[model samples]
Target: MLLSGQSHAATESRLFLDGKELSLPEKVEIENLDGNVMIPIRVVVENLGFKVTWNQKSQSVKIEQRDKVVQLVVNDLMATVDGKQESLNAAPLLRKGSVVVPIRFVSEQMGMEVDWNNVDKVVSLITPVIEPTIKEPVKVPPTTGSGTSSPTTAPVVEPSVMLSQVNTIQFSENQLKISLSASVQPKISRLTGPDRIVLDLPNTMFSDSFRASQGLDNKLNGRLEVSGYPDVSGVRYSLFSSSPSTVRVVIDLNSAKKYTLLTETTDSTLITVQLREEDSVNIDPIVPNVPAVNDGRKKVVIDAGHGGSDPGATSISKKMEKDFTLAVALKVEQLLLQEPAIELIMTRNSDVYPTLQDRVDLANNMNADVFVSIHADSFSPTANGSQTFYYQRTNSKAFANVIHKYLIKATGFKDRGVTENGFFVIKKTKMPAVLLEVGFLSNSDNEALLFTEELQNKVAQGIVNGIKEYLGIK
Candidate 1:
C-alpha cells in the first residue's frame, strides 16, 4: 500500500488503468504543473507493469520497465531515461514522503499512454494488458448539432418541439441574439472544429422563406449570402435525422465565442441565443480609438502571466491559475492565427516563467500595437467576477474598457468593471496595454466553468474581440 497525504484527502482524484479503477493506497496528487499533469511515481509506474526501487543514499528512485531504465531524484529537475539526461518541465518532488514525477515524462518514456478527464478529475493510463479488460463506454445522449459538439453532455431531446424559422439574428452590446420561431424549447449543443454552435429542433422544418430572406450579406463559396448579421459567418439548417425528425441549425462562427440558450416563457416561438462574438469589431465610446494605419494588419502580443514557481491562484478544484491562463492564452493564439491581417506575438508559450520586464520588452521591441496580459483572479471564495486593469497614465484604459465589457459578457460572470492599476507589464509597455483577470479562481462555480474546454475557448475569443475592436479590424 502506498502512503497518502493528509491534506484534504477527501477531494483527492482517482487513477484508472485500462478503464479499470486502481485501488491506490494513497490519494493521488494529480497536479497541473507547467501545463503538464504530475502524479506519484509509485502509483503510476508500478501499476504499469514496472518495477520501482528507492535509493535512500542518493535520494533517487530507479525504475525498470521492459528495456527502459529511468532515474529521478527528489526535488530535481533532471531525469535519466535509459542513461540519457533529460530536463523536466517540473521537478520530481516528495509529497508527504511519497515521490511524485511528471505523468507525461514517465508515460512517454515507458511507451505508455495517458489521458486526463478534467470534469471527472480522473487520470487514465493505457498499457498493453495481457488479458485486456473490456468496459462499457459511458452513454452519451444523441446530439443533432451540425458542427462539433462542445465538451458537454448532450441535452435531453424534446421530440415534441417544432421549429418554423429563424426569425432574426441581431447584434447588440457584446451579444449576438438569435430569435427563432418554435412551438417548444429547442435542444442546444456546441462544438469546436472551425468553431460552431448547433441547435437541434425536434419535429421541425424550415420556413418557406428561410433561405430567401436576407438581412446581411456575407461571402460564402464566392456567392453573396445572407448571414443575418455581421458577427456570424454563416448559418445552415438540415434534416439531421428522419426517425427523430430533428432539424439542426448550425452557426458557422467567424471566431471563438460563447452562447446562452434562452426560451421565452410567454412566447415559446421566441427562442433567443445570447452569443459572444470574438470577431466583432466596434468603436469604443469611452476612449478615442486609433484606427490601424499600416497594411491594415494589427500586431498583438498575448502574455500569459505567471509560470514555473508562480502558482498564481489555486482554485477550489486545485487547478493553478497559471495553467488556466496559459491554456486560455494558447487558445486565443490559435484563434488569432485565423486572421490573416493580425500579427500575433506571445510573451511565453510554455511553462517557463517570463519576468514582467521581459514581457514588456518583447512587446516594445516588436512595436506591438497592443499588449494583453492574461491572468485569473484570486480572492475570497464568495468573490466571483471578471475585471480588467489598465495603467492609469496611458490610453490602456480605453483598451481595458472595451475588452472587459466583452469578456464579462462572454463569461456571463459578474462584471467587476475596468480599473486602473500600475502593474509592471502594463505600466512598462509603451503601446496600449491591458491586464485581464478572467475570473476569480476561488469561486467554485467560476473554477468549474474555467476548467471546461468551451469556456476557455470563449474567453480567448473575448480577448481577441477586444483586440479587433481596439485595432479597428474588420
Candidate 2:
C-alpha cells in the first residue's frame, strides 16, 4: 500500500524553473528510476536548444546540441555522448508510446543543473550563472495519502522525496544512530555472509551536495573505523534504484543485533541499530576477502564482461557473452592462482550483474594497483578483431598497451588495436584500468575460437602475462 501510494504521488510529478512551474506535454511525463529523474526527450531537449530526432530504423533517439551529438538506443544501457561510449545504469524506456530518458544524464550532458524536492514531487532546473552553488535545504511539509487518480492505461511511477544526508550519531560506545534527511518509513533487512544490515529507503535520492562534500577522500566514502568499537565496523550507502527511487544504507557490523526504526518525528527520521557488545561474540573486523599475498604483490581486479540480465552479445550459435566472459574470467583466475606474488579479485564469479558503480567501488576500496575488465566484442561479422580500450588517463594507456600486446599476440585475431574511449568501468576506476575485447562474437571464426577451452586458456594466459609485465614481475 505504501508503494502504491508512492506510485500515485509520482503520476502527478511536476517541474519548476527558477520557482516558475513549467507545463509538460501529455504521456511525456517525468519518471524517477533509482534516484535519477527521467524526462521526455522532446520536452527537455527542445527546451535546451537541441533538436530531437527519432530513428525508427535503429530504434534509437538522437539529440544534437551545439557540436555534441547524443545517441541512445531503447532498452540498451549504452549511450554515445559526443563520439565516445558511456554506460548508463538505467536505460531509456517507452511508456505509452512516448520516449523518456534519464534527465540527470541528458541535462548535465547538455550543460544544465538539476535538483529534486521529494516531498512535493517537484524537480528544479537552472543554468549556472557562475560557479554552481548548493541550495540550502528547503524544509517542505510532507504530503499524505494517494494522489489524484490517473488514466487506467498509464502505470508509471513518478519521483518522490529526496534523501538528502546520512550522518551518524554516537550517543555512547554501545549506542549508535543513523539519521536521514526527511521523515519517511524505510524497509530494513539483514544479511549474514557479509554480516551487515541494509536499509532500503524508498522514494529517495542520495543528495548531490552530500556526495560532493564527501568526495573520494573522506569518512563517508571510505571505511570509517572507530577505535575501540565492538559491535559496528563501518557504514556504507549508495543509490540503489530510480524506478522506485530507493537509497540503500549498508551498516557493516561485527555481529548480528536487534534494531529499531523511529519515524515518529516532525523533522528528520532516524533508524537506531542497536550495536551493543552483547550482540557480538569474537567477530572479526571486516577485511578484504582477497587472499594474502607477498608484502608487495600487485592487486588486480578482473571484471568479467556481462552477466545476469545483460547478456553482452550473442553468437550465431546462441552462445551468450555472459557464459564466455565467465569461462574466461575463471580461467584467468586459475592461472593467477598459480602465482604466489599476485593477488587477484574477480568482480563476479557467478551469473550475476554488478552495476558499473559497484565494480569501481570494489577496486577503489581495495586500493588495487591495477584493474582489468574482460569482455567479448560485438558488431558486424566482418568486424572481427581484438581491441583493448583505456580511458583518457596517463596510466590507462600504459596498461592497455601492455595487455593488448600480449592479447593480440595470443589470439591472432585482427588487431583492432588499443583505443581511447570513455567506457564506464575503465573511466571511473582510480587505478590503471583497461577493457579488453577478446574477440568478436559477431564473427563465426572468432565465435568458434572463443567457445573452445584451448583458446579461452590462451586468452587467459595473455591477460595473466600482461598483468605480470605491467607489475614488473619476472
* C-alpha lDDT of candidate 1 relative to the true structure: 0.66
Clashes of each: 5, 8
lDDT of 2: 0.67
Q: Model 1, range 190-236, lDDT digits (tens) per residue? A: 54434666566555544445445432223111112332233457665
RMSD of each: 22.1, 23.0
For model 2, how many clashes? 8
Per-residue lDDT value at 30 in model 1: 74
Candidate 1 residue-wise lDDT at 451: 83
Tell me the TM-score of each prediction against the true structure.
Answer: 0.39, 0.41
